[model samples]
Target chain A: MYEQLDQSIQQLMWDVRKRTLKRMQSAYDVAMKTSYKDLVTTVDKENERFIDDHLRKLDPNAKIVSEEGLGDKVTDLKGPVFIVDPIDGTMNFVMQHRNFAIMIAFFVDGQPVYGYIMDVIEGTLYHGGPGKGVYCNDQRLHAPADNDLHDSLVVLNSGITLNGGHNFREIGLQARGVRMYGSAGIEMIAVITGRVGGYLSYLHPWDLAAGMAMAKELGLSVKAIDEKELDVLSSNLVLVATQQVSRDISELIN
Target chain B: MYEQLDQSIQQLMWDVRKRTLKRMQSAYDVAMKTSYKDLVTTVDKENERFIDDHLRKLDPNAKIVSEEGLGDKVTDLKGPVFIVDPIDGTMNFVMQHRNFAIMIAFFVDGQPVYGYIMDVIEGTLYHGGPGKGVYCNDQRLHAPADNDLHDSLVVLNSGITLNGGHNFREIGLQARGVRMYGSAGIEMIAVITGRVGGYLSYLHPWDLAAGMAMAKELGLSVKAIDEKELDVLSSNLVLVATQQVSRDISELIN
Candidate 1:
């Protein structure tokens, strides 16, 4: 039954990816008129609507949470719940057009059962179920080799790092290097693929839900500030890292 | 004659973009035996060779300066020389396969005469010749509005921000926000397109050559640290910003 549900959700995600891509090509230019900081294009709204409608049809009983306000309101994340970010990295979607992604995760009783992150331009999906290992397209991904902080490149938010938010600078100083690729979904893909040992950012639930699902499946540590289990309903400073690297980073930052 | 020269260089740049794209797709999955920090993939060398060979045919007498050592020895910036970075943001190219770009610039008597930055996957080229308006794929771009620090977004390397390089914290505090996009070439494009007010990063010459040309032509300020004119062949903390935002950030950082 879980396998059947996973297959259906994957199909839904692919459809979402296609519809989002078409809308983005036409709507990106319109964002130029809006204030750059507050730039949200017509595509963002349309994509979220498209995804939400399809998701409701697929799982009528599930509560939906999303960034673009297309999903239902729910006080608690119990039973089957779907978290969707129709377009993660709206700035990149409106401005750069390539770094943005479509992210969706299915959680059961506060635990992610499935996650999907699609790089729309490349048509590549990084996805997996809890017991089924991660896959980048058709190829299965092995768990990343254990890596240490001094030997690891990390992804961090420049704003947070500069503001000394969540002790970001101490973590930055201990790592081999730091990279910031804007989109939380894409950065999470990097972490799952082992391109970066960890990713640290203050992000919304829709921004993290899908990627967090994949990270946990790939044997990486996923935690909120103070090293607690992630609260999937609010903004949190999330850390996704290898066990050793997470330990080193947490020690520095904490 | 200048028109013909510009067309020739643009054609060469397109070819480089195509070849690099193909090479990158095929080579990204190879395992690294060396340290990740020092890992230079086969594609980098091959892409540099392809670019160097084509540029040499276009300007046989011109010295070629390149990042990957596959070009002519360019100890002195003399005569009409071509500066090329076959793949800027090589780590992104290797790890993410999306954020990187191909950069090229022509310096005549050490003054930029032409520049090209190609988004390899998107096939969009930002190019211009001296006195010829800057363009992204045939559409002319207007100079960004004169923005102040409090109303502007600045792009800086996350590493630099964390280490307090150039007082990035102070600069971040003054600006509307700070973003780290991980690619100097891409960050320059952000500034050119008005998505970002400025980009500050410690950059090598190849990284900044093409970007500086575009920024300067579009009425943006491109300066070295301490408000000095940038020497074309040296590494420095380069600042590319709109005129007013540059002054505001410089005051904050200094």
Candidate 2:
């Protein structure tokens, strides 16, 4: 179950979260990471450093793979590993000053053990993994009720949907509604909490790492858009949703 | 400019808002007003009644047209008229319990004078019209920067998008992103606050009445999809956006 490990991770996450909130209150520099569409701020780098130091202290033997390049060269997940995104929605943070999140995933021998997705402004921590089950803050969250695509609200990525990438527009039409909150972590948390039925995006390892872990525990399916399984080491066009929703979406899109 | 009327209406709105918040805290009844898609709650009825009574008290001669059948039945906007949607985004209120708003528009001799759209939960009020510049809460809102169709977020109605109404799929693809917040008032507010570039929906008079007033003050263009001027008394495929965005979207779709 890794209950003990979950508890430990939760504690570490809260500490990191508090640090992040404090940093956000102060002015920080911003820079483009890939394009103007992709951004990083001083807060992201500082938070990454803070989390990296803490993780190193928490489990010296564990390898850390993080978004900010402050961790090890993580080519394989053979040993205990922590995948981290210091600030998951940097664009939202830079623009809306809300909807951003901090994420961390704990894995052992290539299997997810625990995950945490913390909404920085809302002060929510969605954390857990398979066997232990998922949770939002202190409340134990039940898996979302199964609903057909036509009866559920789903989250979609803006660029992907607009570009017709992965047939997102067709899938979006089937859902009761579509929300674009601009944060993968926040969107996945919505799926786990049943606020939305699913979230689809082309995401990097760090973007989906924590969310995928928690979602799996909630009996939600997390997989590649194509008929392939996901590997933690790479990026994929991912779908996180209830089993029926995943099946419905794939059947329509594929 | 109706400066004195704006002040008086603002006071009345705050009172109604306070009452609505208190009522929301207590248990309330819900019933379908039309189909399963349309809903009315004790809260909606109560809020409508409260606003209607207050508006009557404010101006006995003014004709009030409201969504919940609590106001006057006037055919034309010949005198001082108030067009109100006591609770815009009723479905959102019924399901998500948030993202809904209270909307009101004041007209004098068939010309829009002042408007208000208040997000109850966030406690932010967006109000203004015509010669009066729009304001979000206490701060004045400048007109959003002009962007092309491919550079801005647009909000759409789920039913319309899914049904392929008004070439929604093609229009959605042209925008930088699409968001569905389930509330017309909130979506319009997003446009006013520069959170999104535009919002298009097939809306009744009560849905667009309030937003249309304030949007015009911010130099945004509100029009029908068929290149016709909005009647504001009839349902139409409405487009609300900056001048450039509106032109780009219309050119691409029409």
Candidate 3:
């Protein structure tokens, strides 16, 4: 019975995400007529409102923390909360029309229970509930084998190295190679799919919530600074990696 | 009659590229069985030989300059020449299946007369001939409206700020934003489609050949350092952009 309910919710969320993507695409096509760098279009705001409304109707008791500032201001993660990032990679969506993802995470008393990351253009969904295993589209994902730092690839902001921001230069030297794809949601997908061993970046709650759920389900580590569980309300440098690689990288960075 | 011949050659080249993609995919899938980065397959030589053999029958007088060195070595581009990169973005192809492209260019008397950049995963082709308009799949591209640096989005390797390999740090500061997608072919697509105002990177001739052709046809400037036509045999920092944006960026970098 619980499985049926979860599937039903998944289907509803999937439909909502697809509709939101279409609307965003149309708005983006129109916005191309003007300057591309201007942030927060009407479509972005409208889409967030639509999702928030639908989620509210579905779970009236759920507290929402969203990027667009339409949700409650709860200081603590005390109850059922839906963390939403209406558009995780706004710049990528506004400019490239690819590499952007819609991220949503459901947390119970500050612990994640379910997560979903959708690649809009490719129509791929990465989602899983606690202990239910992760899925990319319809297929199940097995945990990627344990790998070391030298044999692993990473996703990071290249500007970190250039600007001497947050010890990124040292991190770059430790990894075999680094890739910058410019979208947090897409970067999370790479980590879950084992294309890259880990992803580290400074991100907001909406950006990290769904990805944290998916990463945890894949047997990958999802932690805040110093290997602690993430604080859902504040921005921090997060790292998601295999246990061994995470240990190696954490020791180096910390 | 000439049009039919051109179409036939295009079809043959496209088929060859598709096969090459499949071979690489198989190698990657098998490698994933043991480890992700442990296998670096040597299909580059075989793929180049296969493509060169096929092109020879269609254009017997065409000189071939391929990455794997399977073709003739001509000192001067005196006649028809086929520039080929059997596997562009080899690292991405070896590590991740989604971000690579196959590039081919046809030059006549030392000038790019035709070119194709195929995104193998998505199966989209950006192709054009001299005197013909550029295309993505079958849709024609209009030259994007002129954009200024402050209003423009640019793509560059994120490491530019850290490695100081090229003058990327200064350019990154000047643009509205910077994106790094990890493949020269895909990055070129961002510019051709007007999602980005420009792309700058140190690239080899085979890597830039097809992209240069498509960029030029789309009314974007394709220039080597010092603002000269690119020599088709050397590695250099190449820039592709709208004429106005390119000029603005050149001044900033200089």
Candidate 4:
């Protein structure tokens, strides 16, 4: 039902990647929205404007949900909802100028239709949805092996293992090794591409929307921490993992 | 005195990157050396052999110290010494097939003459040493700005912050963020590129040698924790950072 739209959005993402990278090279200002951890940049806003405008041109009727407040309030996913995260790893963007991503996911009545995660620096776009099979650029990406925690590495952020009361430390020890790259979109790429077994972090709707869509298409699982129903309109303590690793995480936690 | 030698080694590193990445695409056997965390693959042995032979041809009198035990067992760095970490993130290699590196460093009479770190997946060769400027893929890489903990991100492993008592958690909270990518070579690349402020980990001679060489050239500090003098023959708890941030780490620890 969405093949033509998928090709259009993928082309749009390539255009977004090129223009955003050019802006990064030319000039951009960095500023903190809440704290040093939460950063926003002029490039981010400009990119959001660029993407939102293009998305509007593509699907003007879609209700948009964006990270930088350039789109709609998006109270409900009642219709075609467009979720945009212009630069997903804002701190990495502000600090390292790499490891960030441009993400946009299209949903219809809360069901993900076509999701896009463009690794801006590498120029590899991970895009697809239900019935579409995932693609890392032009190649057909394979689903990860159904390996459990013992044989696979996991992606983590320190807050879950250090600040919160979770068994992430134990999980890290059991799961071959632990890797922490501070980008939700990039880390999700890790999971979607089968590079890591799973990823656990507190992620916003915009941050996980595209990743969740791609992961699901690749036969992986995405869920909230407590196994509660995930609310697409709100922040979620998210876990995206291979099916076996998902059970392994629960087994260890329990 | 060694301009010609530098270009030659850099070219050799680029070749090593190509061969290693090609080997990764083919069949390889993964085995546990000490634990699941310490992995060695057939490709690691092959890459070491490839690099050792090239180094021998480049400088016949040099001694080699290799990770997979494919090189010499010399006691001290009395003459030209070539250190090789065939696959520096073997776990990442065995699992993810990326985030690994092929590292080789040349030292003359215990002084770093040249260093090479090739990020195999990305195909970026970061190489240089004393009297030579660092280059990231032919671009003159600039030394990172001297920034303190609060304004910068830090790299860490779980053992330090979660298992050992090093004030790393407090230090992480104070810093911009803490990143842990699991590969010593890749993490060191992050430090050399100024992507992150510092990296702290327990490192072996082969793991630290190439990074130590290039890092020193870029004006970053490489030190043993507790201000102990590092022994090139043994493993040490290493810290690589900007000078002021090195002081900041000491302050937080004390």
- The candidate maximizing lDDT is 4
Lowest summed lDDT across 10 adjacent residues in model 3 chain B is found at: B29-38
Please rank every candidate by DockQ, starting with the best: 4, 3, 1, 2
DockQ of the candidate models in sequence = 0.36, 0.36, 0.43, 0.73
Task: Sort the candidates on lDDT, descending order.
Answer: 4, 2, 1, 3
Between candidates 1 and 4, the one scoring higher on DockQ is 4
Distance from true location, Cα of A126 in model 4, Å: 0.7
* Residues B1-254, model 4: lDDT tens digits: 77777778888888878788677677889899998778898888988898899888888999999998989997999989999998899988888888988888888898888888899888888888877888888898898999998888999876777664587777788888889888889999999999999888889988898889889989999998878888777888888999888989878863
Residues A42-145, candidate 4: write the lDDT tens digits. Answer: 88899899989988988889989999999998889998989999999888888888899999999999998888999998889999888888898889898899
How does candidate 2 fare on TM-score?
A: 0.85
Candidate that scores best on DockQ: 4
For candidate 2, write residues A165-198 as lDDT tens digits: 6777788876767777778888887788877787
Q: Which candidate number maximizes TM-score?
A: 4
iRMS of each prediction: 3.3, 3.2, 3.7, 1.2
When 1 and 2 are scored with lDDT, the better candidate is 2
**Deviation (Å) of A76 in candidate 1:** 3.5
Model 3 lDDT per residue over B107-184, tens place: 888887778788878888888866777888889988876787776778775444457655777777677677766678
* Model 2 clashing residue pairs (backbone): none
lDDT score, residue B114, model 1?
A: 82
